[model samples]
Target: MTAALDAIDRAIVVATQDGLPLVDRPYHEVARQVGISPDEVMNRMDRLLHEGAIRRIGVVPNHYALGYRFNGMTVWDVADEHIAEAGKRVGDLDFVSHCYHRPRHLPDWPYSLFAMIHAKEKAQADSLAERIACVLGDLSRGHLVLFSSRILKKTGLRL
Candidate 1:
């Protein structure tokens, strides 16, 4: 990640950190800005991904802007020993945006598995939460859900 980048690489990073142009040929446009060919842009991107310079390159839509109003964070008090396997199963759920195990704070917070569920309504999110609960089965001691009343725009990090 250090010696792998040059001026042109930095230029491409700057051009795309926010987003690729919403055009027929966004890579071409980025190449033009970076003083390179479209194929060069693609090649560099491929290299970056192959070398693990970047985690992922993809579109991150604003679910709230797309009418997904009910944003819920579902938590489950899963056994620490079984958390890894349970998180994997929950992450595979279609309605689950992402699921991972996190450190839990005792005396108040006891949930270890966390997943974000999105839907157009509260009821829909609740239903999705139930599905996740069923998947967890008797593995989890309990579960809780909290929904956001307002949209929280997620602007992917750029630098």
Candidate 2:
């Protein structure tokens, strides 16, 4: 079920959804745009979070600008019975940005778990993949890393 957002709540989301302004006081900036006090803005944001209107308020960094040029989606062929445990272990790693389970395709694709890893160099990415493999141990039937050739804009749902 979706959260019921009033006009003020909708305004707040619209004001900050693109991204909070890069100002000294982002909340104040949002308040100015939404015609509310800074405190009210913050209070409403807190309530919105509790209501599940927003998942999180955090940074979306440009990894390429940060010199993390190697982006790979590492796929693993894991047994169904052990997928939950294996996914948690892989997702807990510091280098893993994203991890989840996916359905396998018979005869061709056998990978069931996917993890995204980023590094400054190809060798570093390969080493990270090896580390993931070591973590998986015998549970990992096989694995492969598919590197991204280009970057894509990451955005959240529109208001």
Candidate 3:
């Protein structure tokens, strides 16, 4: 099913995604910039969320700034039948900020469930992954843990 988004809706999304205004009246500020009433901006935002155009709306804190400098991408070779269950379980963990299934790319590696874990240090991140593996069961075909040594860029969606 497709939901049509009018110009105003598009504008609201584009503007907000760039970074919502930081002020006492952020909605009003955004509305003024978009040439719409504050009510209109709010209505559009509600509609967007209801229609699933926007899954969620909130601030994205910088993990590094929060002293969570160690980040890692963990890959697990979960069975096809258990991928959904395992993914959901892993996604629910607080340490796992991102989790999803992706097609396997070989001959170097083959893993289905990909998850990103951030922690104060490498050992902590690795420990979290190990815990997740234990919870998901050790029957997985294989698993790989990769730590991030650098961050190239971190930004919101570009519309």
Candidate 4:
């Protein structure tokens, strides 16, 4: 496992989550705000990426405003042995924004894989989900398509 990050390292993560500046001296700007040397900022970011403290550093946009207004959480009950492969296949679709495997909660439900798909309208999103389900075939045990009504919060983690 990776070692825990120090306070400074954590700060760097919180600061850069949105994205690094698109300039020749981007680290310099980050260092100025975080009160560290540019080289130190670069080194710390490298360490964070290598140690898995951070995933990818990139920009996150509001898909809705960009015309992908319809967002749906498509859950699937896929076989345990094939869950990973099925999730990968669904994630490969152009409409899929995120996809992963989650444990099924019993009694009332049993979905194992969850994928987020975004499109211009509900029909398009639903069609995309159906196509993904068809691809999984027998491995797909059950599926639910839940359309998003609103976004409450979208922010980065605070250090």
TM-scores for all predictions: 0.92, 0.93, 0.83, 0.79
What residue runs in model 4 are displaced by over 4 Å at the alpha carbon? 1-11, 17-26, 35-40
What is the C-alpha local distance difference test score of each model? 0.87, 0.94, 0.84, 0.84
lDDT of 4 by residue, 1-159 (tens): 288878888778767776777678889988987899999998988888888777666667788778987888999988789987897888888767789988988857789999988889778888898898888888898899988888866765655
User: lDDT of candidate 4?
Assistant: 0.84
Q: Candidate 2: list runs displaced more than 4 Å.
A: 1-3
Count steric clashes of candidate 2.
0
Query: What shift in Å separates residue 125 of candidate 2 from its native position after superposition?
Result: 0.4
TM-score, candidate 1, is 0.92
Better of 1 and 3 by lDDT: 1
Query: Residue-wise lDDT of candidate 2 within 1-159, one digit each (tens)?
Result: 256899999999999888999999999999999999999999999988877888888898889999999999999999999999999999999999999999999889999999999999999999999999999999999999999899899888879
Clashes of 4: 0
lDDT of 3 by residue, 110-136 (tens): 798999988897788879988888878
For model 1, the run of ten residues with the poorest summed lDDT = 150-159
List candidate 1 stretches off by more than 4 Å: none
Model 4: per-residue Cα lDDT at residue 27: 92
